[model samples]
Target: MLGSMAIRALSLSPLDSIAVVVHPDDPLDWLPALGNSAFSASPSAWPSIQVVTCTEASQGMSFSIRCGLKALIDDNPKLDAVVVVLADQPFITTGMIAELIGYLSERPELDYVATATDVGGEGEQNAILMPPAILSRSMFEVLLQLEGDAGARKLFGLPQFRGAALLAADRTTVFDVDTPADMVLATKQILGQTYIREHRF
Candidate 1:
């Protein structure tokens, strides 16, 4: 998942860092130990990661969000913005992340830039804001207030985030990977597109 997420900052700058917030007992055992850990020590590959254990993760998504943001803040006091992309959304592309960053950078008046897919039944559709969002430093404190099971998108509708913007993303690019069946379908989607691209040459 991390391999697919190395996106350059806006202006083609180096993608500085990434901090993965894992539960203390999460199965991804290879994560390194080098943050303000809430758990004991244990020690990865490209981009060089530092795992931040969210002991209060069970409390809600807010805790995890706060934990991850705190780690980033501690590391880079001058952080411009942050892109909160979920690991399950492996199909998220670098171009998508860059757009979020670039758009937010261009509009300092905005609190965040978010991606949304058209979701609806039958032939109707509506833009439903989702993650893989880029939020300016101004929005970090608001994110800390998110509650149980609430995602970062929760704050998008609030009065404080009035100037937030949304970018439409293709549905397939945000295909969620929550189940084995979903993984199978995502693999087929990737491979099918690869096959088509290769033969088109």
Candidate 2:
């Protein structure tokens, strides 16, 4: 999943850099493998690619997010914004990423741009506010305040960030793989197979 996500991210023409964050207890040597594979597959993208390791991954998702954001900022201080992409979201495409960046670029007044889905009468919900989303440098402080399992979505509730949020035109791009069933669904979607509904216990 990580490898596929990395390849797709690196393939984007709008992005100048890519960061892959790995947890300390990832079991596999994903960092080196990802680096090697990326270099082998796309030598030009390799230099811009960075593998970040989060020693405090056990601390939760916020730690990993902090680690990756810090690494990207440190690597390129001139960067105007950072796009947070999760490895588990295989369905995310280069076009979606570019769309986020392009939307933010066209609207300098916005602080952040994220993908959202309309949940029927429930109104719209932030699909993930991630990977395919863009966060300006001004929001770094707010992002750093996140902790535990919390994510950037927490900012959505804050008054200061509410009005600045811009939703992407496409909502389906936010789908991600969070469980075995999700992986199956993703595979089925990718292969154009008909979904087989199953009851869960």
Candidate 3:
């Protein structure tokens, strides 16, 4: 039901740019379209759209995020804003992303704009955005030094990092593909049929 609802829900606007970071063997899927629609087409606008790859992504989630951010900044030093999106978040629609971009577009001074989802299992909603603040190359490096398993949460509570723009979205938005069970759910949702049922399980 969550997947169906996500497919129907109206979206906001396209982000200025989206960072689609994934592992080496990850599927391309709709990611290339996201890049083409948002970044590749408009040269004068946010022309620097990119799909970043984390060579060390095999290490863990932290490495993937750190690598992606570094790649973005390394390629475009003048980037004022960015949105970090995972490769498998099929529910993350263009409208939701646009909402975040529109908010940041209005208030450029805001450090970070994250999509907040109520993953009830966590007791509190989780924030999905990276750097979690507007940081310079040096600050990002320092944050990278702090990296462990948990990733961006380490820098979010820091002093210099201003704060995050918590834009509320559906809880199902954060449903990530972490395992085979997750894969089943994704397949069922995308195809509108249960994989288990199809396989006679």
Please, what is the TM-score per model? 0.75, 0.77, 0.61
Mark the regions of model 1 whose C-alpha exceeds 4 Å error after superposition: 1-14, 27-48, 120-125, 193-201
Cα shift from native, residue 138, model 3 (Å): 9.4
Best by TM-score: 2
- Give the CA lDDT, 0 to 100, for residue 86 in model 2: 69
RMSD of candidate 1 to the truth, in angstroms, is 7.3
Off by over 4 Å in 3: 1-53, 119-143, 165-167, 193-201
What's the lDDT of the predicted structure labeled candidate 3? 0.53
Which window of 10 residues has the lowest lDDT sum in candidate 2? 192-201
Least accurate stretch of 10 residues (summed lDDT) in model 1?
5-14
Q: Tell me how far the alpha carbon of residue 107 in candidate 1 is from the true structure, in angstroms, after superposition.
A: 0.7
User: What would the per-residue lDDT of candidate 3 be over residues 11-38, giving only the tens digit for each residue?
Assistant: 2234434455657786656444433432
Candidate 2, residue 88: Cα displacement in angstroms equals: 1.0
RMSD of 3: 7.5
Q: How large is the C-alpha RMSD of every model relative to the true structure? A: 7.3, 6.2, 7.5
